[model samples]
Target: MTPLLTYLAKVVIVSGILYGYYYLALRNNRFHQWNRYYLLFCAILSLIVPLLRIPLQFAPEETSNSYTGQVLLLREQVFTPAAAAEAGRTDWAFVLYSLVALLCVARVAWGYWKILRLIRHSRLEFIRPYWLVLSDKIGAPFSFFRYIFWNSDSRFETPEYRKIFRHEMVHVQERHSNDKLFMEAVTALCWVNPFFHLMKAELALIHEFIADKKAVAGGDVAEYAQSILQMALQSRHDFQLTNNFSHHPIKRRILMLTASRRLRFSYLRRLLILPLAAIIFCSLAFVVQEQQVETRAAQTAPADTIKPPPPPAPPRPNAKPAKPVFDSGGNEVFTFVEIPPSFPGGEAELAKYLSTNIRYPKEAVDKNLSGTVFVSFIVSAKGKIDSVRTVGTKKGGGLEEEAIRVVKEMPDWRPGKQNGRQVAVMFNLPIRFTLAKPEKKGPDGVYTRPEKMPSYTGGEGELHQHLRSNIRYPKEALDKRVNGTVLVSFVVMPDGSLKDVKPAGDKVLGSGLEEEAVRIVNIMPAWEPGREKGEAIATRMVLPIRFSFQ
Candidate 1:
């Protein structure tokens, strides 16, 4: 999976586990406040646990293919959307994700707009530590940040009114609106995640339960239940980003309010499962390391069964390496080791990277100079390149400079290692600079279209068959599992001779892929020329040559 997809998958997994455990352990608990925080905690864990990483150190590989005289290519390539589209890339999944996310955002914005407009039209009734918006537009009571939206015509007695006022006041004081907003943001971001939506619904219901419990404190619970039923029978309304009195199921609210004996320390059950869940989650998040004793035994003995472990050897005066063991950056390095540094995809990818990225200097091409320049650098223990320089018999005409420039553009490589430990190693690369022979254009003018279009000797199928038969995947790219289609454009002259063959787009897929495509096109049999006014004419044509291993 792509990195983004992987991250989302992790989030989904974490949320599923936590949510499943909660439903089984604490879902029906009467401890509304504890349940509320725990649910929020689960949301936080689901969102953030995937981002945490625990680095585990281990012995390095016994055979690293790092600096085996290879250039490495980074998987990263920057392309503008125009360039990507030109290369025939269209990510429909990304489009869908963006569209859904935009809708969620618009929904949230609309909710805020409705709240603001209601507050603008309604008259404010000042209540100590909070305020109320009395509006006939609202059919039910709901609490926002510090403002409560109440029906101008309420059908409750003085005692019931006080109890209901306390309910909204509880939401305002405890800042449950912020929790709803946070829940909104999560659901919006992970709209496809059923657990997030479930969590949003669960959180809102929990908020109601919390308000009910606080509102009925030292008051008649039966009367409050009666008042809820009275409000239910009246015309109702609902809105988002607000604590609506009638938004949740009426029966569940009354039962939770009347239920006695809070689930005492239900968190204990959750805590018991946490360590086990954490252990499993951590195993996936953390890196596995090499065994310490096994590494030592592997370096010394042929068989682990026969050896008891050797004692430390005596220190020598020349214990330090004769050559510099550390680079200017203060990291330990090596001239040679069990494993040499390499590119991410190894030698083949290295070759592809160099061929694709290294461009011959304009000055050198103009002066018709070609040579091989030797470039050297350090591949650090962590696969970083440093200390880049060039050395060779051939130097001038900007050849050495260009070689150095491209080498410096390189990212980190697979670092060299010795005795199962990572160490930096020296890297050397030889880059060849050569210019292609410029093709001479025919005297006949190229035409976009004529009275008659050009035709292959046989048909389009035969032309494709010829390309498939003759074109070979570039060896360097093939070794590294590289594949792409090259769009080659050329002209069929009046006499049916092909000329000016080249890739047709701004995208340059190097590593000999384009060269192979061009080679196949140039060697094709001549086509029957286009015509205009009973006379043969040259016509431009574009052909797509695909190189797919599968």
Candidate 2:
């Protein structure tokens, strides 16, 4: 069952249980009957609610795949292709309804079985005064025990036995047992319902009331009361189905039987049940319908799928001179451009290679051009790089130039593929630059740049190409059209070359692509470590990249 339907069922069950208890406690005759009717209504409604919700008609999935679309299309085309889907969904609802119905039937059957069990264990006997067969069962008072066999239990006083026999006969003649059997099945079906219990108890009380009145009509009330007392005082047998002359509130039953007052019936009281049931159903429907509307609204709300902002790029080492894109502030601007990628191994392998090779740049520290730069790059289907572009830049030492150099030198990256065909994808990178403090130690316990140099693993062509293809621009960043390089610097480990970088050159694209560029530069196939005495050494070089919208 759907969660919504399950919730509604729980509500029905709980409300029914509570209402059942309230009427039971009050014990008004009219209220008792009304409560039973109300319970019946709840059961019927619970079964029907899910059925009503089955979307018999719906909008075509081709036009739109949302709930609203389905609804609208249903109203329009009447017989859209989406009708099949709607039918399939409604079929499930029917299945659920069938299951709940089966459960209700099973529950009713169980109740009948229990009643039979109670009857089987009750004591059945024929006793005196009125010479009637009586079965004393403990569940609902005055109920006939179908499984009981009439017999005489020789343990009763003359008048006491007589009154008990008369009462039992009244029950038998009234066929109260059959009435209780029907009620039992209904109660069992709604067993989780507390109201069923109340109704059962009320029905039992009414059976006794009617019997008591009959017994006194042609007999003595005083004599009957005395006989009831005597039977209580005598040896009482606990039989599953033995009808005892006296059971529960004997004094009250005697008084009510003798009293000359007739129960007053008010038109208003009798009329209350129908309206109350209607109100309850209407309220439930309104609540559930309102919730459904809200759920449908949320599912149809528009979501923005525009690309994210470009990320910053990492600092590059000794970047070659290039046409500088700048702002009014004399600062360089690096515009993110798309590039193709080369995938020698695959996307997975490329990701691993990038993880292993990318590193921070050290020259950025010497130049003190440490900031975040956003770079954009593309990946081609054949694992090759077309171009790497930087968007933002940090000022000084051509920080943008440094970022571009690192990205341009990136190793070839594995291309991303969709359905066996190679597709150009854009990716973004952000590089951060931080100056090494004098207190910081380098390899060999000394500031040797070679031993701590950053290395690349795969072909530089592949990594560069992938970045260019996947890069995207941030709407806000593009809208501002801000152009200015924010040069960034970071150390490349092992080779101590420029790797990570952030550029403050331009805000035309968001910062994500710029950051992506930095990461790719850091992941390029390892460069031959700058050497000092043929030993691997780390060196720092600073280069700046440019950014400009095409």
Candidate 3:
């Protein structure tokens, strides 16, 4: 589920539990005012709880697979499972939910407009601290904000009308209309949630109970119950935002009105809500992002541990090299055997094998280098890899060593055969080492070019090596597994002294990461500063130091 969908699901679950508890424990009771507030609080809590995300982190279980192949594979873009899933498909469910929610909100607004228009059409009859809108179209007495909707044609006695007026006035004075409006909005947005509508229904009944109790504070309860029944006969569902005078199952209203069945110390039941809310906070408030150690390790190679191939042999002056013979008698290795040697499996396994075995050397990556190396080796009669040697003329810095290591550990192949007997045969595999180019930075108060660019002592490789060896992941950040790159900018001074070392770029990674990056660059030794027209001058340089656990 998308984040939005996850939130909606939580809302449904939380509201469902709260409403279920209310239905089972606190409905149609003497604590009418308390129940009304409880329902509203539940609605508010359900919506708010999902938003509080407390992230919990755990170290992933470690796993390993030993491989025997040497081709390092790197893709330019690395997508996590969530990102890939989001990229490949549309969240039509969330889209539909949003559309329906918007329509529900529109309906809420439209309901309010209808009520307002009715109030406009019917002239107000002020009866001291209460405004009444008498309209035949409105079949029942309902309160919207301040105005009370009333039928212009009267069906009740004068005394009953006064009682009804008092009942509607209770809704207005206690701001019960606000509670109705709030629940109506909630029910509209979560129209699919039966509990929200049910909660709204329970709330409306509570509102009527509250008004009935107040309207009959000193008067006769039997007459008040009779008035309720008379109004219920005429009432029907109208504007959802309005507080109807007789919105209910008439029997429950009459029963609650006459019965003295209020639970003693019923407020104690309210204590249950606290613990239930705590349970919700403990369970639904957090998200566990399971990041397995194996998966994270697979996501990125530990370049620090990878050793590159040694440089190619230099030319020897006035020297002759000796070659080893195939056997006791000198013989040449055959290129074409009756049956060619094969890997344990076919090409697909061979590719997987190579990918599994090889990891790009940190040296080459640090220097932004990439190249293809052709390797030649012999598959002997015993299916053992023998006489491995690099064939390519172009030497890829540090790449050949990793490729060589991979080939040496490969599983024994199916030996080649000549005529009807096994014989020595040669095989050549071409593997490429590639690195994605880092983003190039633009000039930031620094020279883009000079007569001679500044160079760190021991060159590019050593500078990166220094950073890798000395820089430490900040303890606070490492504990939280916050991974990112901090780009550092500094000026190499005229006297080969460093100055103005600070983090560069618009993206300032906090958590002391940028501070850590800047600190390491600051501690570095002086460099050979850039010179313009035979004069040494300070030049700005950008270095991006990436800290990652995956």
Candidate 4:
């Protein structure tokens, strides 16, 4: 959802920048054809730029006095469940957006339907390479593709009629209907954005300016301006897909018609769009690339360095203990130690310390930014916490800085011992900052829905690892070569323990697959309970476990 929001924001930004540039640099220019193509190209580019994934290199900033540990351990994990029949959740926002867009589409279709109805009843006359449809329903002259609709009562022999026909003819010859149709589709898709409507209007105005110029070529500009004003007083059809002769700003059209032609060199202003587009593309792609690089670096670096050092031999029980050794990076490395480090009071105390000390940033709270921040640090041989830094920031809004600050302020722990000697050990902790309070509840006593769902102790990755390690393929199902996904439903209790674990559907995956899946889930470790508001709640979840023969 965050990535989708980011992509949409980029689309808006790119479109805004391109349209702004067009208004400033090329709006009043005499090169109508060039401006028309420029606008179309920009619209296409804005849609394409957000989908590009470009790799970029940036020098990571170094924190003061922070030594790089040989192994990186922290990571941010988000759980997004696959679509399931049991969840049956309706995304109301998406439904509303789709409904509005559909309304716009139906509105545009109605306009075309009106035009087609008029064509069916009117008399169609062949006029050179165009078809002139004479209809009483059309109050004014309009061109749709190669067909031009003129009022049946109009005086075709008059000079004013000739001028109007010529203007409509220019639209048909230029195929301006294609541009109208393109913008109509854009309007249907982006009806929520006012700028898109403005863009459509601007494109239409540009079309009029170009057609008006070509209509009066080698003739008097004042006469063409007069024809446009006279036609503006008459009624016009309200179809979106057609180019009506009087559908644009009369003053702008007249001014553009009489305005001095721009110098050829002035057309060079269109080239500015190249740099504008490149800047927008880079701005959108750089932020996404930076985040990807940070996540990849955190996961891959330390694991690559810590590749299972050979296990140390057991020390003699009666002999004096040997001191631990330091790696070339000046950080202590441990493979097999006599005793691992412990927090001041064990896991419960560590939890108490985090809950009591962690403060949610006001900025983050105001913006409703919530996610887990993974902080990695070292407990030195002297039991002091040092080298505090954030390895993974799932969602940034000063959350990472707050998490790092809280971790750095933590008291010293009991350092690990290797053969009775204190040794430094790397520690990773994930601190979740949520704005939800536990007191909030829906209509139901139990929270059927929550802002944040329950997860495993470490993260979703660890949950998968636990499942893979614990789940045993049933011999009956394996021997019969039965393979299918079994949906298991369970309630994650307020205390983060599983309850009511059972298969959602009866005998759905035969051969004991469903039974085996339910058994595996019941034996799983307690999860970090899901929360609604700020309070813990029992949330029901359904997971699909697959059984297959190797």
Candidate 5:
């Protein structure tokens, strides 16, 4: 699954457990303050736990192909084919998710705007530590942060008015607006998650329960309950960031107020949160174990396995003497040769020639395919290219055909040298196909040189630590002895979000190794965005991760 989907799943699981615990054990208990704090803490914890990765260390396994002489060249090339008339596909799921989230944010913003306008138009009066706003437009009393809005029609001299004021005071003094604001932001981001909305409603009810308990202390509890019932019948605007006196169900508030406090020992039931948190941590830190048995079996295989017979000798008696040749498995065999092979001129000339002659296939262009293709061939003793074939271009789509055709068309190269004579030698060449284009500019604008370069939360060392802890080596790669470095490139947006993650070069080690590298990169937390001239800007970055069994 993608990282976003995985995070959403974790949120659902954690929220479900917390909500279930609240409903069964703590709903009717008299620990209203404890319940209020628990909901806020759990909500924040659910978002954080998914990002905590725990590293697991194991002894390195031995492998046969541990030679380090073979050089691996990493080449990155971008291709943008001439714009074709292909129909564009719409990402409906992303569109729907973004639209819903925007609507939720707008709804929250509108509520805040209404509250601010009410404060602006109403008469402000000082009531002890609280600033009271007398608004004739407001139908019910509510408290937001340090400001309390009172219905202008209510008589301040009455006993009922005094009781309502006490309830609003509890909300302000305890900072209930902080909890509401946090939950409101959560709801806006995850509007599609019905659980968040349900949690929000439950938290509002908890706030009311806490305020009701404080309001009735050392006073007539029965009379206070009657005032709550009367206020519930009045019209009220349900602002998300405010604590409204009569917003919660009237019966639940009155019942909670009158219920006997649970035994102090029963409060230990809250300890259930500890075990629930542990389960969540373990689930998020899941790791895949390497297949030791298969690795052992491979290590024990016989070295003297059946091998192919030697190639037949040349028919001409006067032909040049044969020289040693290495098979694909690196095993030595005799072949007609003399000198080792070399490209005409030198390595520099070979690169220049390939770049000058290679053509991007029209078929590949139409499909927007771009990558490197590795071509392997034999440089004959006569300095002629023959037996030309492609080693890997697993991204087929006519790319392999184009690479092979270019190799066959090359002029004769310098003959190989073996035992002071010309000989045939194997040669591997990688040709890249790219459509020339300019660097991409992000929505907020791209930065070529930034005052502060983007980095992981801690530093580059922490990024490596994160990758080492989270990357899961593919089992197929281990069994086949496929190991190499995979280069991944991504764009860090101005808002510190990652986008356009992809492999920077052709896949060197197949068997899902490259895919695993890309997955790990995608799951990384956003970096500190780069800044240019004191403003955040998008910057592209490339990272290489190596996979090895030994």
Candidate 6:
């Protein structure tokens, strides 16, 4: 699911739970005095957990695929009997099922642990007049019990204290402890729902409002405020389960209590109906998402069914040169061809440049534009860049414009050359707009570019002779069982020399192939390196050396 949708779903689920809590609380009284913010915070955390969990679910499988695709294939092969013993075992589906099961177990265990801790800390305290109260020593209600009255050394005869006591009494008489336990349990279970915490907070607030109204209906508000302040000052942490007469934030409680309005039963009834509607809608949305995912998977099955093409054949060491080649053949072939390199720079440089030059077209930034744009074109024979196109990953006009504009301003390249002349070659580049780590700076504050190397000017016949004499293929590659290409990039220096031999492409062809190609290239008979403006400077080049069995 998209991040936006993921967030929305979390919000809705949490909200529903809160609304449910509020509805139930209202059933007891119209003006209850409680701290709603506390509950809201709890629900918010719960919501975030589940949303974050969704992405992590696929992490193990993705890592496995990246680290060892062969292992995954092997698992699929060896476990066929057991897999066949079960039903429905598509790779992705199996992975998803495992993820879901893991998440469920983790979430349940975490939630149970949290609630258990809360219950333990809220040791039940039996007090006077056959009343029970749960307190965390912060004057907040830990559970339902009789009205608790303890603040200062001196017992106050204030009307506010009386009202507060009455509020606690209401909680005790109505078994508010049980209701709270239920609410917390639900909130814990739905921790991934941001709205859950919000709803819980709302419920607590409404509950407070109801109790406050009942207390103030017959007396003075000023006295109640004074009593709350006094109790708060003298509150002790020793109380655990006893319901406290003095709860804070006292100001919020007072405001809620004073605003409490006697509403008709019909109003609450209407609210109940709305929650039912919301629940149904959310359920439907979830179901639709599931169906869409299944449909997409079905559509993708055919595409994946197209087995990977057999790896390309390795170039023969002593074979005749292929005709119809772009560059010259025997006596004119180059051991190395150089292509100019370009970089937008390290993170800091990019940030600095963007800060000063990136105008982000206010509209695009306002709309929060983000995407990866793939720009592919050719570097001309003379190293000039052209045909820059922006293919958007998401539908954002401004983002495309910014990307295209930036690409157009890129510095000219020292075009790719082959044999003794330049040649146009296709290049693919990906530009991404994302929050990433800053580039690291070395001690001396120097940014080093890859060193340039010389190019070769020799015939294909000479190239073959050199390769046959020096190349040493890995045992595996020579075994004719591995069919893969090794793309190597090395420098051919000014005076018929090879330096900085390296692999410039995929490693799937096997690291062995790459090393063999590099070794052969390094020892090959050198060619005259390409020159620029009568000066022979080091050049950069890429070469694809392939190995195959058939």
lDDT of each: 0.67, 0.43, 0.66, 0.66, 0.66, 0.43
Task: Give lDDT for model 4.
Answer: 0.66
Q: 80-140, model 6: which lDDT tens digit per residue?
A: 1122223223447445645755675566457556544544564444565633324333243
Q: Report per-prediction Cα RMSD to one decimal.
A: 17.2, 23.6, 26.2, 19.9, 21.4, 23.5
Regions of candidate 1 where Cα sits further than 4 Å from its true position: 59-88, 125-128, 155-157, 262-267, 289-385, 388-550
User: What is the TM-score ranking, best to worst?
Assistant: 1, 5, 4, 3, 2, 6
Comparing candidate 1 with candidate 6, which one achieves the higher TM-score?
A: 1
TM-score of each: 0.57, 0.34, 0.51, 0.52, 0.53, 0.31
Give the higher-lDDT candidate: 4 or 6: 4
**lDDT for each residue of candidate 2 in 1-550, tens digit (9 for 90 to 100):** 5444665565556456445544544344433344444444544554444333211222111211110100100000011113223333455754665676578677666655765665456554344322223343332223354332233344345654555545766777666666566556655454555555655555656666767667666777888777666655654444322334556666666666666554455445545555665665554443211101110011111111112234423224553323544433343222221122333332333333333333334444455554545555554444445456665434544545655565566666544433344455544444433343222234534332332332233322232233344434433334444322222234434454454444333343344435543454454445544444565544442222223333
Q: Residue 377 lDDT in model 1?
A: 79
- Give me the overall lDDT of model 1: 0.67
In Å, residue 6's CA in model 6 sits off its true spot by 8.6
Which ranges of candidate 2 are over 4 A from the true structure? 1-151, 154-163, 182-195, 233-244, 285-550
Instruction: Report the C-alpha displacement of residue 176, candidate 1, in angstroms.
Output: 0.9
Where is model 6 more than 4 Å wrong at Cα? Answer: 1-129, 132-143, 146-160, 233-244, 260-550
Clashes of 6: 45
For candidate 3, give the lDDT of residue 389.
75
Error of 5 at 158 (Å): 2.7
Q: Which ten residues in a row have the lowest lDDT in candidate 2?
A: 68-77
Clash count list over all predictions: 8, 164, 1, 9, 13, 45
Residue-wise C-alpha lDDT for candidate 1, range 214-308, written one tens digit per residue: 99988888899987888778756647899987655788888987777756766587576668567756856675422211100001110001000
